[model samples]
Target chain A: MIVSGSGLVEALRAGRFVVTAELGPPRGADTDVVRKKGRALRGWVDAVNITDNQGGFVRLSSLAGSLVLLDEGVDPVMQLTARDRNRIALQSDLVSAAALGVRNVLLLSGDHPSYGDHPDAKPVFDLDSTQMVWTARNLRDHGQLLSGRSLDPPPDLHIGAVENPFAPPVGFRARRLAKKVRAGAEYVQTQLVFDVGAFAGWMAEVRDLGLHERAHIIAGIGPIVSPQALEHMRTKVPGVHVPDAVATRLLRAGTEGFTEEALRVCAESIHRIRAIEGVSGIHLMAFGREHLIPEIVDRSGLDRSRFDMNACGSRERSADAG
Target chain B: MPPPRAVPTRPALSSRTLYRLHRLLEPNGLYRFVARVVERHAWLRRPFTRTEESVKRKVFGCRMCGQCALPVTGYACPMTCPKQLRNGPCGGVLPDGGCEVYPGERCVWLIAVERAEAGGHAGDLERLHRPIDQRQWGESSWINYWQGRDDGLWTEPGGRATPVDLGLPVLVTGKGDRER
Candidate 1:
């Protein structure tokens, strides 16, 4: 059933298990990179997330990418990071994104610049991610900016935030989500879940706190692609926890059969994560391997017939009718 | 008792003692007297600020944001975080509780959560801490706390269901207010 506004929000609201995927805009001005990825993800996922300078590297803006995705009939969850922009720029971009018919937004603190390509760049974390979440919520719900200036037409947004359940202070991770929910995060996407057991442990705490009922908790998953990528994420990526057993399994698959084994691992994770209560959906992060998502989703045993691509496009014309 | 020294060489008081001391100084009258004395006695202010800074710097690696979050954060200083996050751990924290930016160092929030849970102040992590008061940087947080300068630092009332007031100008609800 096609909704008048954000299909991702509508799907989650309707209690349909949602699926979202990431799309990193290319470093150059080329629109084709975003479009090609968007086209590939259109029917398979409910919404595509356009990253905001992902990894702190300079790239085509997530705002521009979201616009391109809109042209491709895919709903875009435009990510807005607090790492680069202060309150003014952040709010300005948010208003502009809404006026241009961008519906979903994911607020993040972003990777510190040191982690990105430009290690020398001065980091601008004027507002932490939680504050950004609260700021966006106020703009959408109260029709006011952080400065208390009234917005004639406040940006209508489905506010979201990111969390890493496998990170340290795992016990406090769920409470952090609770704070975001209190700050008006309607949905949350987690850090990559290579360790399903640990992710489930965090979800159990989330359920204990009844946070799942308050906010849509979407588990993050990704196609490992290669043992090299697996090792990179295991050792290098912050917040990602890959159990040694999974590493052993993937490494044992060897180079020739690695692709098949990696996809199988991701698909199995999705299957296991689906059974965990409070998992409203999954956010697929198949970075640079967008083509693998459809097969991974199919392998996860999700009822693909229920994923109606026609109903999932951004419906801008009828968006404000509500 | 100090929760296994975050930096082994650093010396400090136990978090429980600090928490108790913090609670003791929270009453307005006690801190207000100190604030007034520090304000009136210019000669003494420098020594007072210096002593507080040097002591806290050694104990907590405090960056002296002039609004200490130590009590709420289980004595772990959020200002020391590479990103200086006051709310909670960011998504980039390493799996082993390492800082995302400084891979070798432990993420402060992880230590904070563990210490907070151990110290029986786990509920404070859920509070929506306000952004740093930039004007207070380098000043003594004790004086700021005593003068009630940091009283409004929380976006919402702690442990309450009050409506959020970020200290912004009040929202103009009516059409008449909008016209003005």
Candidate 2:
């Protein structure tokens, strides 16, 4: 079943470890890749997040990809970015997504224009991630605009925000997460996590500040594909750290066996994360390795029987079935 | 990629005017008068220059340059400036002037409108619809300015500290270093 924000929260309270995966749409107008990825992860995850622009590079609209996922019987967490839209567009998309029964959303401030293919294109940060969370909360809970104008019917959305545990001034992430929670974020999914200790410390701070009670915190884990990919993540992706031991193992595995190593690493990571008391769930960013998620889940020993498999067979299944 | 550009300097604001305004508002009587005037008329608060017709025309023809507010509004420009959409709105402006983005807060534009009206230029309201030139300044600089003002450092004696002084070495690094 498509989990509502409250449902996700309830699941966390019930000690269920929510699992989420990402689906990156193709760069062109094709929906095949997105649909395939969505279909592949159908019953393996709680929700499949359609990335707006993974790594800030240009790609198909996340909304479109999310729609495809919805069509494929996967609950989609449509990633909304303020980088290219104003409040009006943002609201319109939210309402549209809700109307289409795509309830989960990941609000993002998005990467700056400079990071994308179109550096000269103007960015529209009408609302930062925090403000977007507030907007989502207001729209969903109050059924009103900022001006208090009532919506014909308010949207019912599961709002989530991103947290980068590896961000510098690392101490500030917890506080930032606290602010997001204060702003009405129902859940927070972190950026790719390689160091469980760092993530644990960050969660400790969140607990200390009482934010844990307000939002479901999901640790993000991206499966490492190769030594080169691992090195790229460590050096290229700022704030993402791959531990020396993990990096060494992946390197020693070499190119051909990297996929196996990746699955093992990810499975272990999931296991470690699932053992954490305060951690509510795990967001798997398999990066183009969508096909391996089911294997990773199986190897990790997570209980997938709880997810609805019958719904995965057809697109017409009720979203609430799961 | 080209080397990162040097950080630009910020425009100067009159401390005398700010102090005078601060002092004037400190007295309950004067503050009430200003507040009363601002409360009655929306246009009086945020002054704009264009008429509805002109604004509409520009909106249809907007190139999205976002220049209208950058030079004048100090980086506090609205995301909805018809023509120039630099950044998103504060996410606080509610449909009714209360900010949904910032709970229990008045919209920034409403505050600006009130200030303009209180300052005696109600006609400026029409100008609020003008197209803005968003690219007039870099996003980082605009954000830096925004942050400085938010922290109350922008109005402090000497100009607010640069990203460099604030230990943002990345801001001073090569091309891609400070882009984001």
The number of the candidate with the highest lDDT is 1
CAPRI tier for the interface of model 2: incorrect
Candidate 1 similarity to native, TM-score: 0.89
- Per-residue C-alpha lDDT of model 1 across residues A1-322, encoded as one tens digit per residue: 2234337987787677788999889999799999998888877888999999988889999999999999988889999998898888999999999998898999998888888899888777777888888888777766777787778899988889999887777777888888887777889999888889988899999999888998999989997889789878877677688888888888899998888998999889988888899889999998879899899888987765445456444322221101
Interface RMSD of each: 5.4, 19.8
* DockQ of structure 2: 0.03
Instruction: Give candidate 1's error at residue B138 in angstroms.
Output: 2.3
lDDT of 2 by residue, A1-322 (tens): 4434223434554557788888787889789888877778876887888888765688998778878887887778899987788767888889889888887899977655564678777666655666567667667765655444658798988888887766543544565565566556778888877888877888788889777777788889888887767777765554466778888888888899988988888888878777666777888887787887888878988766556556444432222211
What residue pairs clash in candidate 1, if any at all? none
The residue ranges of model 1 lying beyond 4 angstroms of the native Cα positions read: A1-6, A306-322, B1-11, B40-47, B155-162, B167-180
Chain A TM-score per model, please list them. 0.94, 0.90
Off by over 4 Å in 2: A1-14, A311-322, B1-180
